[model samples]
Target: MGDFRRSRLSSTPVVGRVVEWKKTHGWIEPECTIDHPEMAKHQGHIFVHGEDLVPKWRNLVAGAMVEFFLYYDGQGLGAEECTSRKVLRVTLPWKHAKEMFGESGEKLADFEQQTHVTIRAYQWCQPDGNNSDLPFLLFEIWGRPQAVVESIGALAARREQDGNAAEDTLCVNLLLPESRMWKVDLMQLQHYCSLEVSSSITITDPMPCRTLTIQAPLPHFRSSLHALIAQAACVGNLW
Candidate 1:
């Protein structure tokens, strides 16, 4: 009888929306009662604690969708191991040399320079053609200020004229549990950022490896680009 009761009360993963969230605790409203009818007693409310959320820094925003399991914690129904279904907007910090002509290449006085990117959790097929359960973050750099656009264009033009084709690529080194390098075309970057330019550059396929060194035309630019990728990884919980 005890086992039966437990089975009846506990539920499989269910979809719900966060109705209210405080820093410590919150309430979620289950979308349906197909599996757990007891939810009706609490008016479709499921208790969720901040500790139960995955990627802990990301607190559930009100009205955001979530997937969780229902279990009776003696006192009442609660959620456990909750996963949020919201896209994350992350800011990638970038700092360049204050004076490019300087020998030491001093960094800009303001360290707060940044651009915004959107990241969403996705399931991607591995080279082995198997769909891994691990969450892959798909991020796009969508925010390009006029200054940034001009800077990138100048760097690309300078690198292109040098005749080293590799220097014209933007290298994104993902420092996750498994490190990987993704090389994107400088021209593609301009295009994606809505810069008016024509180019015959083709996108490079993602190169997965245990370790790789990130390269760029200039040292300061490489450092800034590295920081930007690191920020994205941190926000996506891939670090």
Candidate 2:
């Protein structure tokens, strides 16, 4: 299950067309003018203009019905518009998602911290606008979504002292697709079932937040691990 806190606060799916793209917005890249009916129906829904930090997204055209996720921050305004926040992910057509997010395509893993992986799509897009340059006609690779509904308490704890297996006193857990996992040579447990490693002698420390994406792995488990390891070094029984 996805984290209830994360799902409720962030990762709200919004559907709308790129109504406009004004060059006058700025220099780095144009501002996305998304028109979602949810805003009108909800009354106080704010017209959000999100930024696409992905340089390749420069080809996005107006009038394209795109699926995207919004970041959340409690505010007095009816609908929060985070100019600083970009789309958590954009869902495109299935065939299109493969071409775009597939290995040879956009390869979003190279950029974003992919997690809470999912596949979603809308029926169709209006027959107007220049959506040909768009990767998928009706599908999107919903890459980043939410944190896993898990906690440190849910994870089994263990201690290690020597050998490469026990080398990591603690580590952040990350789940990655087999395909992307192949390209990345980071040290990972071969068989991690039930959040447990398959054959790793090392005791895996699942990260506090269970993220689904393969994104880049975190170096250290957490700062707390440093102190814990330091004290454990002397006593060897603090855990």
Candidate 3:
């Protein structure tokens, strides 16, 4: 009985290069420009704040390509919707982590050695159909509801495809980018999963899907296809 609607507000991901890096309340808050259609509507700038870095990440400079997650409840959303929400946490590139920690395959399971966080892959964080590269970062600022996330979350839970599931449980994968991968970074990600979670989420429960491609039924995400469709009135009744 996982509520896809409820989960939509939890947290979202983004990918981009650093536009600005600030020391906010002694923490690093970086603003990036995402190419999502919603971003295009906003003129393409989003703010992502991070409380603590893994010490090694302290040197992350501006212009560094990175991907991270943002949590925005949007109690007081305004025209500057991107930074309207609070940034609970942020993550850097996974390759950086792997490079720094050295092939931490089984080492990730032992919490005593963990000093970082991990977030899995999700549609919001991936690149759009039009873009050749993966989207840089993700943020959930208040606007209209995330029509696209809601649709995919609901549909994915209904069936299986690409060897993914066909159950009511929506099968959204969370750790593809490993940005603050709280799914596996147990000590740091305690807020995201069950208390008993200890290891990395390798395979996720999937829903039966009708297609399998780099970007299948859920396509043209960066353009915010569903959002565009909703805007155009093709699927007006869906909302």
Clashes by residue pair, model 2: 3-149, 91-140, 92-139, 92-140, 93-138, 93-139, 93-140, 114-213, 115-213, 191-198
Q: Judge candidate 1 against the unseen true structure and give its global Cα lDDT, from 0 to 1.
A: 0.43
Separately for all candidates shown, the number of backbone clashes (residues 3 or more apart, or on different chains) is 0, 10, 33
Over 4 Å off in model 3, which ranges? 1-18, 22-151, 154-157, 160-169, 176-239
**Candidate 3 local lDDT, 66-182, one digit each (tens):** 434533223211111121111111112345334333364344333212312222222222234452243222211111234334433322322345665432222222222222232
Pick the lDDT winner. 1
Model 2 RMSD vs true structure: 17.8
Q: What are the per-residue Cα lDDT tens digits for candidate 2 across 139-216?
A: 222221122111211121323536554443433333322222233322332222112322322111211111222111
Best TM-score among the predictions, by candidate number:
1
Query: What are the runs in model 1 whose C-alpha is more than 4 Å off?
Result: 1-12, 34-37, 87-239
- Candidate 2 C-alpha error for residue 152, in Å: 7.2
- Full-model lDDT for every candidate: 0.43, 0.29, 0.28
